[model samples]
Target: MDNLQKCPQIVDILPTAEGQVRPMTKLEPQEQHEVWLRAVELAGGKVPTGRIVKDVVQKIMERTKVPNTYQIGEVCQILVKDNPELRGKGGCWGIVSAVNEFSCTLRMWDGEYTIGLQHLKSYNYLPAECEQMQVICDACGGLRLRINRVYSSGLEESVQKFLESLGKLNRASLTALEEKLLKVLESEIRD
Candidate 1:
């Protein structure tokens, strides 16, 4: 028996789906030598004798075509048709600050904010003409104000807070009136 048959490191040559017999593991020294001789014979003696034959795993990376929907630094126009805060604020413009697979960062006149893909309309040219010209706030005595600017700034917040406070006051007054009515009913019942 040969030393290759006695060694525990013997590798089996298996036929792959491609019909090629591939060595799957480390071989004994004698088996390695035998493989070299067989490889040289297969190569028609073109390879030098005693040279080792090794099988290396090569990875082939394929270039896939990925669809690009949007990108950072791309200027896009905002579609505010469904946004209540943006209603009547047409012609307000914005710039794309950052981009990702799902959303993009938008820098508007108010400040930098993030918006979804559905919220964007199309790529816009920089220096786009503001469609809605600045209008004087008739309520504030004709002070020039951008519509979106007014909606996003402290003016809106202050107004909302004031309304909320008024609502609480109204609720308290109603509760007090209900208690007075209950007291009057109790006094009449006693008589």
Candidate 2:
């Protein structure tokens, strides 16, 4: 005997559409993933064929949407939750240079790096923190600053190793080093 709750009729649950899926170019990767999971659940957990999954996901993508949460000019931290490649690169700050469908390009002191949407989180910076970054950028020829990316640079290589901790700090938990580093950098720029 089939369980009524477990095997509910998919037809009744799913809206009847005109058999078309709109462009998914606008759907965020996370949204597309959710749509794919819903499609599988709709198929009774048998893992429907790839073609069916894709079609259903596309169809759902037409109805559902998720907006980009990260914005340009906002500071963001690289999260290594799922991407092992970023294992030791957490707590680093970067300026958002560009935003794409499922990723963003961040300009760092050395260069620009692109990270997928899943590997990013917003960094809450204090007013002073922002101005400090701008100061570093201005002094460095508007180039990216490496103060927060200490993970990439050995502590011994840091002009002031203490600055590396700033990246790990949030607006509410800023450290004195954050301010000191800005002051030091600004002074060095004057010379």
Candidate 3:
């Protein structure tokens, strides 16, 4: 009798004192109904024999769009206004020297300028902002001047040495020397 319970239908069967079998008593209705459904599914249409099907759908949809293009000269104009390094510096405009799908190079007055795809939106030219400014030596009392441009790193060390030598001179002589140096710088820039 215990061994018979291992069989699906036998577990659903009942026994009498003579050991005769009959249908089992109606069990929990809901549980029995679920079991019957699952058993039928297992038998393929009466029971689901193949793998269960699940929906594989994406939650997000991304935008796939391209950007617009501008003329070569138009891009150069924009860089002159927006890029700080190029602003107010005359002769820094030109046509787009080269361009690819993603970026373009502008032939600027200073050098070749490379810009990105997104940055192209702001490209346009403005009138030259200001005249070139000159740097006058404070010590020379307006005698020497140079272009207000970046100097090599080593040049700064030389300037510091010159300042130290000025410190060692007599007050009157140092003043004259400073003026002379300023005049020399002014001449160089003027040349």
Using lDDT, give the best candidate's number: 2
**TM-score: which candidate is best?**
2
Tens digits of per-residue lDDT for model 1, 102-169: 46776544456677554576544344222211111112221112222333343445543432232222
Predicted candidate 2 versus true structure: per-residue lDDT over 34-125, tens digit per residue:
55456657666544454465556546643544356676777777876534666546767676779986678976544678987656887777
Angstrom error at residue 111, model 1: 0.5
- Please give the CA lDDT of all the candidate structures: 0.40, 0.56, 0.35
Model 1 TM: 0.30
What's the C-alpha lDDT at position 57 in model 1? 10
The better-scoring model by TM-score among 2 and 3 is 2
Residues 13-130, model 3: lDDT tens digits? 3222221111111234443444334433344433222121100000000012233364444434433322354434322333465765556675432245566443344334442211
Off by over 4 Å in 3: 1-65, 75-94, 121-191
Compute the lDDT for candidate 2: 0.56
With a 3 Å backbone cut-off (N, CA, C), the pairs that clash in candidate 1 are none
